[model samples]
Target: MKTKKVVVGALAAMLSLSVCSLAPAVAAGETVQISVGKVNAKAGETFSVDVSLADIPSTGIQCLDFAVTYDSKVLTIDKVEAGALVKNGADSKDASASLAPLFEGSVNSSEGWVSAAWSTSTDDASYWLKSDGVFCTITGKVASGVADGTVSDLKIVPINRETYSKSGVTNKEISCGYEKDGKPVKYATTLNNGSVTVGTIVTTTTQPPTNKIVRGDANCDGGVDMSDVVLIMQSLANPNKYGLDGSDSKHITAQGQANGDVDSDVKGITSNDALKIQKWLLKSISEL
Candidate 1:
């Protein structure tokens, strides 16, 4: 019994040491904030949102897989591009480092989310620098029909660890490690999301007069009858002499001329317009 107990204690200590050696050391108090730029745009105009990271460690980060979701009803993503922070390095020496940044995601305008994965090659991850600038820029166009004062929230989400990497694929693990003790380091990060608000929409409208005018009332006598037809005929026969009022005392105003155009096709007035009004009055036609 003593021999068996001694062997069991020795194996437990060996296992403990193995875990310690394999586990990656964590850096304390590291933060990575995601912020978006606010903008005002007219309907059908395009704008850009900068997705930036603040307070990045100067040493650098190795790999990252993150996604941003947004309200598709208020905005639509046009394109996404890498920023200087992750594209280059802190110094000239690190500029030429093996930095290969790649992204894979789908922009769902209908579903209101963008699922993306960003990563660097293993070799590039080792030398990539960490800086306090934008990580990427997301250019989007405001939805043309979105009402004014609408708010769209943009969120950042990092994937979980269980499915992060192919656990059995030999040295595959999801990590955004920092440089530490001559090796890559791992740690927890704090993330912050952002949002944008829609501004007022400008529109042009033609308002009606205080008193509405009846269509086909050429003489402006408040009704479409034979007098209107007579006035229209007179106007068409001699626009200069008769002038939309026949030779009567009451002259057809501009509104009367417009109302006289019963066809409403904006084709201007003629004998046909007068004939149509006559047909409408006679019940030969339902309306002009």
Candidate 2:
């Protein structure tokens, strides 16, 4: 009898523990919902994506906060913003998600929402970057479910060039708009096309820019060197005599931004410049 009673007590305790284990644990205070308002843009154009949320609180409701991430390689954030969104096909903000205009917002928006403007690039002449901005609100309606879009990094870079590495292929994130925190959603849009071509006319006599024809970075190992001196010398023999409109050669620093006679401060072409260029060219002028 005693043994049976002990066994029964143990069974009861186990059953209680099991029941407690099966119960769902409540979530702590502060929930978040994020989604994609839209994701697409054309090079050199401005576009908008939407993000919505109902900020509610278990305790005394205060305010919510949100932000979108972006890539530096493909997009340059001009600013973050928030604004009152209007009904579809409408020109003003009325009743869905967007409420007020947040002309000044950032990836780190305070309170509830924000926006960011970024300079976008064309990977192949087809891409753009955009994002929803943070705006003012009259009420906090989240907790039930969150619905807001996020701005992110977009780039328009070459199809296959190293951004920071020689072997690392280069690609740009032109445009993108997604969400963070709450329930996830996607606005119908895509951005992975469009391009920007900054062209420069190299001397027809000189070979086009290749792994060999680089500026500023003459050594080819990715730095300034003597070989660069030779290239610069070859490019501009007597800036005055070369008839260098100065404008003919680009005052550029980016690869494609060049369209002018290269003027190195190294004075006249030096033998050291030749050595560096030869290293990158896999041959020397004497050998060629």
Give the number of the best model, judged by TM-score.
1
How would you encode candidate 1's per-residue C-alpha lDDT over 45-82 as one tens digit per residue?
Answer: 66655555555565566545455678776788877676
- What TM-score would each prediction reach against the true structure? 0.48, 0.22
User: What are the per-residue Cα lDDT tens digits for candidate 2 across 91-155?
Assistant: 13212114322122343223222232211111211121121221221111112111222223322
The number of residue pairs in model 2 that clash at the backbone is 83
Candidate 1 local accuracy as lDDT?
0.52
Q: Lowest-scoring 10 consecutive residues by lDDT in candidate 2?
A: 137-146
CA lDDT of each prediction against the hidden true structure: 0.52, 0.27
- What is candidate 1's CA lDDT for residue 40? 48
Off by over 4 Å in 1: 1-24, 89-106, 115-117, 122-126, 159-175, 179-184, 200-288
Total clashing pairs for each candidate: 0, 83
